[model samples]
Target: MTVLDALPSVEHAAVLDESSKREIRRAILTAIAVPGYQVPFGSREMPVARGWGSGGLQLTLAIVGPDDVVKVYDQGEDGGVNAANLRRLIRRSEGVETTTDPRQATVIQTRHRVPEDELRADQTLVLQVPVPEPLRGVERDMNELRRMHAEGDYSKMWVSLYEDLVRNGVITETTGYPCLVGGRYVIATTPIPRWDVPPLHQAAFLSLFSAGREKRIYAIPPYTDVEPLTFEDVPFEVEKVSARCRCGLVVPDGDLQSYQVEIPQQDGSSVWACSDTDWCTRQRVEAGLLDPSAITETEVDL
Candidate 1:
């Protein structure tokens, strides 16, 4: 049987323990009532490294059921070492099916990039955040940062960015962009590509950001305000690609290119694919955009 066909059918009760479901339900309710507050829970130790997607796994285990389809991606690709590692853990621990199709997934755990397509309201996107503090650079003490946030003191962050612009012609930030949620809470939206930032603004889905090592959890519920930290004159800008994919279709507006060596048996030919492997596979299937070395003609013309 094909890999897809060989997969076992989901059985809800078999997937989630009663205790896990109760814990997650409580956390979700607490998150909603407190708004921007961080809710600490008994985070379990995973077989993977602590800094990896442990935070995502914790949240997933809490909410995932036997019947739910899970999708995990790192830098947009399912084949990335980190994504593959997490997928194995989930399958072994929970026995839920995994997929590359965004439409089929009920839960998606991602690092550094968000899917190019708009997420549905029913979907839950969990981000693996390395750091989740907007005031972390200035105040090393969590207590001090909390006070700064309480007083709405963000002038230091603005000044730092201004100085960065003076030194380098543009804002030198490449990841871990800070944003304001509900116009009150200054939250770090994690390292998602700037291209995906706009989608988080009043998005339809629930966006959860967690830093396991740092011991923090934050949320941006549907229809909430989320704006990138920017000055009035210097508006926030998403990344741009100068060239389209050689496959003839325009790369998803914010998709980034990644390189890998492929040795073809014929003459040791090499080629590259989307860095976000899961994203690329979905695009390939849905849009019929084939890699130059894989096929002769465009499989499906966009």
Candidate 2:
């Protein structure tokens, strides 16, 4: 028998040791203390790669409790490969309830996109960040980036936006948009689409960001001001989905719901549906259009 198989079976409820969990908890406390400021921590090795939701896994595992109902998703699909695997990890933790419904989840971890449903104050949204620094594009040196944040000088980023507007005729930036948080720090809301950026502003739920590759954790507390960087005349706009969802729901451009082309059909006409599968299912079920048993967890790649 293999060495692992030969050993007596053992059950461990928590993933990280108490010492490590405590350290992560301390860092999260500080991240909340200074909203939008990235706080570095000792990132531990995980079964998954660093950039692909490892950071988020750490954050979820660190704070998850016996009573917490956890939800994990990639681009809002609960059954996405990344989400399923991460959920598996947490579900393995004894007494930690897991659910697909955002309304029931106490802690929801996400990558790339936010849920279509409005989040409540009781929930904690943990966002996985591939790159934690907002100034990384403009400044290469870490010291300079730190100094820029400390001095509240973000002229370089402003110039970058100006250049983007001048050259592209419009701000082509969509995902990973930079936003000003608490009117003090410019934070990188990486991987989250422009459509998802608005919910971070004056949000009822606490938002936490973790980047394992960069070993940084940041936070945006409830009801904080989060403004997207934009010119005075050119107001920020989210992406437009021309087609109505397959469920016959058509929200406005900046609505909380996000749309994605449903599995491409042979007819070439793209079919759109809510990216947040659980939310869509719940909506239809509530409307009496879909049966509760008809709900299926769909697998998607972010």
lDDT leader: 2
| Model 2: residues with Cα > 4 Å off, grouped in runs | 1-13, 251-257, 261-263, 266-269, 296-302
Per-model clash counts, in order, read 6, 0
Tell me how far candidate 2 lies from the true structure as C-alpha RMSD in angstroms: 3.6
In candidate 2, the residue pairs with backbone N, CA or C atoms under 3 Å apart (3 or more residues apart, or in different chains) clash, namely none
Cα lDDT tens digits for candidate 2, 1-302: 53223323345545567788889999999999999999999999977888888888898889987789999999878878778878867767434778898999999999987787889999999999999999898999999999999999999999999999999988988788999999999999998988899989999999999998999999999999999999999899887777678876555454434656456889886677888888887778887898888766453312
Tell me how far the alpha carbon of residue 249 in candidate 2 is from the true structure, in angstroms, after superposition.
Answer: 2.2
Candidate 1 collision pairs: 76-276, 76-277, 77-276, 77-277, 77-278, 78-278
Whole-model lDDT per candidate: 0.71, 0.85
- What lDDT tens digits, residue by residue, belong to model 1 across residues 26-54? 77667656555566655556556679977
Least well predicted 10-residue stretch by lDDT in candidate 2: 2-11
For candidate 2, what is the lDDT? 0.85
- The root-mean-square deviation over C-alpha atoms between each candidate and the true structure, in angstroms, is 6.8, 3.6
